[model samples]
Target chain A: MSVPFYDSGVASGLLSGILFGYVLEAAGFGSARKLTGQFSLKDWSVFKVMFTAVLVAAVGLYLLRLGGMIAGNSVYIPTLYLWAMAAGGLLIGAGFAMGGYCPGTSLVGIVSGRVDAVVFVVGMIVGTMAFAGVYEPIQGFYFAAKGPDAQRLPDLLGLPEWLILAVLIVVAIAGFVLGSRLERARGGPFTAEDVNGEDTSKAKNQNTTFNTEAGIVP
Target chain B: MTSSPRPFWPPLVAGAALGIALLISFLITGHGLGASGFVTRLSAQISGWLAPDLTTANAYFGPFLTAGAPLASWITWEVIGVLIGGYVGARTAGRSRLMVERGPQASVGQRFAFAFIGGALVGIGGRLARGCTSGLGLSGGATLAVAGFVFLAGFFIAGFVVSALVRRAWQ
Candidate 1:
């Protein structure tokens, strides 16, 4: 009883990435301004899309595993490296605030024809090289924690996966419910330019002209 | 351009679809989804190609070179597809436009600098954590991985904390 074809490694990576990319674009993450706005009290599309995707996947995986459809242990989980992951997370987060795009969003941004996104991609490559050059010094801390590799939240908390997942779903629902309102309060429906405090009438005009030219009814 | 906020897939629907896709990945590959691993592998390969002796000498690069997929991996292929799919989705949705997006107050040059710096940080961070948002936050969270939880917690805190300092960039 194997699960499905699209679930495997390389194949699923391709499928999931494509789907994820589509989802990201649909959420308007290709626009750096839209993404950065999540940090602002302005718009929260990033939170909305990200949490939605996470909760949906969390519940889905929980149910499938509970149903005996897939072996939970078979799922790939990285070995725990506390210091490395923490430091990396902080660095990456700082980068997010500065750059406004994750690896995933940068790809989508580049696809959507954003020049900044392209520069971001090049930066990623350079960063990788920089890290590699200094890999020797960092490797020790990076591989420091060789804890029980069978680490999972449920296992760590000594709770059932189903129960933990259920709680997560509830939290996601609440967040979404609250987030929508917060977004509206911040700025109901402003363009990236507007949210950034730029004169957005030009963007509005461009939108109207494009819509009229393309015969799009909106 | 319609000025109307484009409709997004409902959160629940989008989540479920993403979940199913992740589930499918687990079922087929005996593992879940990932993004950073490819970058790590690529980085390793690039290092090896650039300086075989140095790559081989490093303990980190040793196992990956021997144990992992070849340079032309499925993950690499999938990333390529992600690029294509992203392009298609953006174009169809009228979201495809060539522009440097930044906070209105942020200069194009400043934003570009941040974009590069942020990207570099992500590259290193993903490798250090053994995953990125896609790998740790999404797939690992789905699978209930402890590392995933830790990574997510760390990332959110860092993002929010730094967000304040960079306020001028966004608005």
Candidate 2:
């Protein structure tokens, strides 16, 4: 029933990573402007793609667990560190906003032959080194508010996992609906034509209008 | 390029494909997608080689040494795959080009500066959170880990606020 190579961590990691990277690039996430579009409300592709992926994976994993095909504990779930996670999230968000790329997307950017992405990756390495250099001082805050090992929402909320999943599905759908409306209000949904080639003059014009409307002088 | 580049796949389609990839990862590796961990390990390993005493004495980079060769880890191979897959995807679509992406008004220097600073912040933050968007946001969220949602909330909220302030960078 099980694939022999699946047991090999290296092989599986490479297989999964290729799929993951291909999907990211094909989704246009290789472009920083396209990704930061979410923050500007100009394009909902980032939100749509991310939410869809989350919903599908969550549901699929849950079903697999229910079917006893995958043990519940086999999948990795990160420990809950409320303060560390929150603070870290804030910093990452700021970085995302300022940098126009995340760790994953930045890699896609590099392969897409982006110089900025290369710089970003170099900076990322330096940042990690810096954190290590200062880890001793911030060790307490980094590990503060540690919760139960591998805690999930259901565990924290005292609700059935299925019920939470159902609710999340509804929420995601609603978010999509809202996202569409927001895109419409801004101008229109961003399309592949916007980033497919050198013919971005039209897209550029549209961006100008959106920025002007948003009260930013570009 | 002479011909127009191919358009990217629709968001929903690509998202579904990514989800399936994630599911497969779980079925095989018993974990989901990740990126920052690889960078951390690589950095730690390199630093270990340069200054074995300092790297091992540090609280953060020290632990990575115990896990054996950093390049031999699962995440390391996965990240290498990411590079290969990304290159293939870009090449197939004719989207591969050497350029610095930025707002029209933003100078090249500005873009580079922001990109580096932003990346550094992401590295620090990802290390602190023990995951990045892919590792924590997507993987943790799918597992319904409270840490995942919490990180997502802070990420989006700060993203909105900061992007607004730095709108000129990528408007």
Candidate 3:
């Protein structure tokens, strides 16, 4: 077959989603503890996983393009909607921290039997409906910045595309280093005792030593 | 816990593999990657089913309805892939368990509330941002889109700030 494979929409997405979910779970993204730990600066698997994936793809795709293999850019490059994106970023970030799963990861969680992840999916759906429902009122501002221009860092800042990409690569590497330092400083990854998946505050209240020997500290 | 909680793959290994997934995604569909778009359309479909007029009347949902049906999308299939793949991953790793993830200091109900609200926020944010982490951060960032960076900055800023207050959720 060709370098660019056939794109049967549903078939494509289904296979892609399966791969996506599998990779996520393998990376430990299915666990809220590992994911949420990023925010607390306790464990950095989240940063590590995200940064590594992004960097690898960014560099790989660029290389493929240079070789004239992959052809043009992705099917869709999200346009710049500054106000809307900024607002969305805040809510999404907060949700990720609080809910402990982004949309992709949440699906992974659901399959892994995490009830909270399922709940989150439900909440996100309701929230989406709410947004769609209220779109009538917010349309003016919601799409105020919407346009056809595809904004790239090079074009926006007048920098060479290669230079920007190089910088991003450098930044991702630096982030990995920082992630390692933060992980260590946080006194190693949280054991089951620290986040036993239930209210173990009672045990903490007793100030008793956590007996991991039995494997059921509570 | 059995086997002291099986360890997950190192980030470098798993992430690079994931990047390959992105590469395949591009090769197959010419699209980078995304998840929230599926949920958004699904939500609209539901809304359309119950209140077709109102859904079609709203500028946001209306435009989407014009494009045939929201039920059919590349995102839906990919998300299905995510579900099956996740099951495989969790099953192989021995990490599949039905439970609500929260800190020892919190309760199930508290976690549920937090989950719902946080999910709602992501729902709102996903639409505004035009994509979620995988969509914006991974796919968009890989493409070097300027808005991708902006969304990334905002997401991390909000996440860091909120994480401080909600430390009990994971700490």
Pick the lDDT winner.
2
lDDT (Cα, tens digit) per residue for candidate 1, span B29-125: 6566566666677777877788878777776666667765435666776677678777888767655666777776888889888888888888878
Q: TM-score winner among the candidates?
A: 2
Better of 2 and 3 by TM-score: 2
> A4-98 in candidate 3: lDDT tens per residue?
67585778888878778888888888877778888888787777777777778777777887887866654457788888888888889999989
| Full-model lDDT, candidate 2 | 0.86
C-alpha lDDT of all candidate models, in order: 0.70, 0.86, 0.80
What tens-digit string does per-residue lDDT give for candidate 3 at B1-171?
333345677888988989889878877887677999989888888888989998888777787787889878778778878888889877766677667777678899999999999999999999878898989988887777877888888888999999998987765
What is the DockQ score, from 0 to 1, of model 1? 0.57
Every model's DockQ: 0.57, 0.70, 0.67
Which pairs, if any, clash in model 1? A7-B24, A7-B25, A8-B29, A56-B15, A207-B1
TM-score ranking from best candidate downward: 2, 3, 1
Q: Answer with 1 or 2, whichever has the higher lDDT.
A: 2
RMSD of each: 4.2, 4.6, 4.1
Q: Rank the candidates by DockQ, best first.
A: 2, 3, 1
TM-score of chain B of 2: 0.95
